[model samples]
Target: MKAVRLEEIEQLFLREVERPVPGPDDLLVRVEASGICGTDRHLLHGEFPSTPPVTLGHEFSGIVEAVGSAVLGFRPGMRVTGDPNIVCGHCVHCHAGRINLCQNLRAIGIHRDGALADYVIVPQKQAHELPLSLKPDYGAFCEPLACCLHGIDVAGIKAGSSVVVLGGGVIGLLTVQLARLAGATRVVLVTRQASKRRLAEEIGATASFDPTAGDAAAGIAGPDGLLPGGADVVIECAGVAETMEEMPRLARPGGTLVVLGVMAKGEKIQIEPFDILFRELRILGSFINPFVHRRAADLIISGAIKVEPLITRRVSLEEVPEVIRNPARPGEVKVLFMPSA
Candidate 1:
C-alpha cells in the first residue's frame, strides 16, 4: 500500500507502506476517495498540532474490505464513511453529550493512520454505510459537512432568518446551504474569489460579494440598507485575522456569531468586551462536529445539501504533494484524492 505521510513539518512524502490489519472491533476499508482539508494544509505546514509520521486524510469514504471478528452490522463490500474523531466515552465531555470536546480524542489522519492509502482501519463504531446510489466523491464530504451541521445546530439558525457566511471555501459554502435549508430568507456569502462568489450564487446564496473591493456587509445594511442592522447570524469560516476581526460587528444585536474556522496556535483576534454586554451578542466557538456524522450521511443521501459544486478537483494519491505545494492550483476548492486510482 502507498500512503501520503508527513515525516516532518512542511514536508510530505509518498511512500510504500505495509497494509494495516483490522483489530478486534475495527473495520478495514479499501479507500476509494478522500478529501484534502484546510487542516491537511495546516498539518503539512506544521500549523496544526499533530503527531509526526501520520497518514494525512480524514474526510473519506471507501468500500469495506475486511472486518474484525468483534465488529457487527456490517460486512465486506459495504460502502462507508466514518467519524474520524475518536473520543473517550468516559470523559466528562462525552458524558455531557459534547464528545467533540473529549480531551482524549484522537482523529484519523491527524493522530493515526488514515485513508490516504490503499487501506485504512477505523473502529466499527465510527463507520456509517453509504447508500448504494451515493458516489465516492459525495461520501468524502461527510466529515466536513458533519462539522458544518454541528455549527448550524449551535447557531440555532431559523427559517426566514437573515444569515451571512464569511468565507466561500468548502466549509463556508456548505454553511450557506445549511442556513438556507434552515429557512434563512436572505443568505449572503462574503468571499474575495470571483469564481467562488459565482458558485455561491448558483448554489443558494441570495447574493455574493467580494468583501475586499466593496462593502458586502455594507451593501446589506448601508444607508440604502437591504438590512437595517445586520444578519441574524454570522458564521465565520475564514481563518484569517480580518474576518475574525469583523465577525462580532457584522452580527446583529442579540444575534449569534459562530466561529467555524480553526485559528492558528497562539493567534489572537481583538474584540471589544463592551460590545458583548451592550449589544447582548452571543459569541460561540464551535469545535469539531459532535455526533452528527450520521446526520451528515443522511443529509448527503437525501440530497438536502448539494455537494457536487464544492468538489473542485479529483487527484490520485501520488498527485497530492504537488497539489499541496501549489497554492494557485486551478479550481482547487476541495481536492479529492482517489487512493484506488
Candidate 2:
C-alpha cells in the first residue's frame, strides 16, 4: 500500500507502507477519494495536537473491501463514508450524546493511520453508506459537511436572518450553503481570495466581499447603513486571529457569532468590551462533527445540499505531499485525492 506519512513537523512524504487489518468491529475500506483539509496542514506543521507518524487522511469515501466478523448491515463492495472522531462510549461526553467533546477521543488520521492510502480501517459504527447518486469525490465531502452541519446546529440559525461568513475556503463556502438551507434570507461571504469569492457566490451567497478592498467594514454593512450590525449571524471560518477578533464587530445587536475555524495553539484575539456588554451578543465556538456524519450523508443523498462545485481539483495519492506544499497553486475550493487513481 502507498501512504502519505507525516514523518515530522512540516514534512510529509508518499512511501510504501503495510496495509492495516480491520478489527471485528471495523471495516476495511478501499479509499477512492479523500479530501485534503486545513487539518492536514495543521498535522504537517504539528500545530494542532495529535500523535506523530500517522497516515493522514480523514475526509474520505471508499468501497468496503472487507468487513470484520461482527460487522453487519454492510458487506464487501458497499460504498461508505464515516465519522472519524472515534470516542469511548464510557466517557461522560459520549454518554451525554456529545461525542465530539469526548474526553478520550482518537481520530483515525489524526491519531492513527487514516485513509490516505490504498486501504484504511474504520469502526463499523463510524462507517456510513453512500447513495448511488453521489460520486466518490462528493462522498469524501460528507465529513467536512458534517462538521459544518454541527456548526449550524449549534448556531441555531433562524429564518429570514442575515449571515456573514468569514473566509472563502471550503468551510466558509459550505457554511454559506448551510445558512441558506437554514432559511437565512441573505448570506454574504468575505474572503481574501478572488477565486474563492467567486465560488462563494456560485454556491448561493447573496454577495461576496474582498476584505482587502478599502474599508471592508463598510462593504460588509447591511442595507441602509444604520448599523455595523448588519449580519444577524457571523460565522468565523478564516482560522485567523484577526478574523476571530472581528466576529463581534460584524454582527447585529443581540446577534449570534459562531467561531467555526481552528486557530493555532496559544493564539490570542482582542475584542472590545462594549461589543459584549452593550450589544448583548451571543458568541459560540463550533468543534468537530459530533456524530452528525449520518445526517450529512442523508443531506447529500436527499439533494438538500450540493457539494459538487466545492471540489476544485483531484489528483493521485503520489501528489499529496506537493499539494500540501502549495494549496494556492492555482484553483480554490476543496481538493480531493483519489488514492486508487
Candidate 3:
C-alpha cells in the first residue's frame, strides 16, 4: 500500500508501506476520497502540532473492506466516514460532554496513521455510515461539514437573523448555506476573490462583497452599507488576522461572533477588548466536530447541504504531497485525494 507520509516537519512523500490490520474494535477501510484541508498544509509546515511519521489525511471516507469481529451495525461493503478526532472517554472534557476539548486528543491523521493510503484504520466509535447510493466523492466532505455544523451550533443563528461570513473558502461557503438553513434571512459573504464571492451568492449568501475594494468594516457596517447596523452574527472563517480583527466589528452591538477557522499555533492578532466590553458582545471559539458527525452525514446523504460545488479537484495519492505543500490556487475551494485514482 502507498501512503502519503509526513516523515517529519517539512518532510512529506508518497511511500510504500505494509497494509494495516484492524484492531478488535476497528475497521479496515480502503481509501476512496479524502479532502485536502488547510490543516494538512499546517501539519506539513509544522504550523499545527502533529505526530510525524504518520499518514496526513483527516477529512476522508471510503468503503469498508473489512470489519473487526467486535464491530457491530457495520459490515464490509458499507460506505463510512471517519471522525478522525479520537477523545479519551475518561477525560474531564469528555465526562462533561465537551469531548472536542479532550486533554488526550489523538486525531487519526494527526496522531495515528490516516486515510491517505490504500487502507486506514477507524475505530468503530468514529465511523459514521453513509448511503451507498450517494456520490463517492461526497463522503469526503462529511468531516468538514461536521466541523462547520459545530460552528453553526455555537453561533445560535435564528430566524430572521443576519450573518456575515468572512472568507469564501470551503468552510465559509458551507457556513453560508448552514446559516441560511438555520433561518438567517440575510447572509453576507466577504472575500477578495471575485469568483468565490460570486459562488457564495450562488449558493446561499444574500450578497457578497470584495473586502479589498474599500474599507471592509465600514463598507459592511456603515449606515449605507449592506447590513447597516451590522449583522446579527459574524463568523470569522478566514482564520487571518484581518478577519479576526474585523469579526467583532461586523457584528451588531450585543450580537454574537464565532471564530470557527483554524489559525496556526502561535499566530497573534490585535483586538479591542474595550469594544467587546462596551457592546456586551458574545465571542466564542468553536473547535472541531464534537457530536455533530452523524448530523453532518445525514445532511450530506439527504442533500440538505450542497458540497458538489465545493469540490475543486481530485488527485491521486502520489499528487497529494505537492498539493498539500503549495498554497491553494485562486478560486480553489476544496481538493480531494483519491488513492485509487
Top model number, TM-score: 3
Off by over 4 Å in 3: none
By TM-score, the candidates rank as 3, 1, 2
Q: Regarding TM-score, does 1 or 3 come out ahead?
A: 3
**TM-scores of the models, in the given order?**
0.97, 0.95, 0.99
- lDDT string, candidate 2, 1-341, tens digits: 89998877887999898888889998999998999898898788778988878889999999999989999998998999978888888988888988888899999889988888889898998889996567888888899899899989888888998888998888998899999999988898888888888888887998888778755566676453323447888999879988888788778788889999999877888888786989899989899998688988888888778788887878898888888776455447788899545
Per-model clash counts, in order, read: 2, 0, 0
Q: Give lDDT tens digits, candidate 3, residues 188-236.
A: 9999999999899889999998988898778888898999988899999
lDDT of 2: 0.85
Cα lDDT, all candidates: 0.87, 0.85, 0.92
Spell out the clash pairs found in candidate 1: 159-183, 160-183
Q: Candidate 1 lDDT, tens digit per residue, 1-341?
A: 89999888987999999999999899999998999888888888888889989988899999999999999999999999979999989989899988998989999999998888888998999999997679888999999999999999999998889998988889999999999988899998888889988999888999876777766557665555455688899999978888988887677889999999877877888999899889999999888888899999999999988999888878898898777666635434788998545
For model 3, the run of ten residues with the poorest summed lDDT = 332-341
Task: Point out the higher-scoring one by TM-score: 1 or 2.
Answer: 1
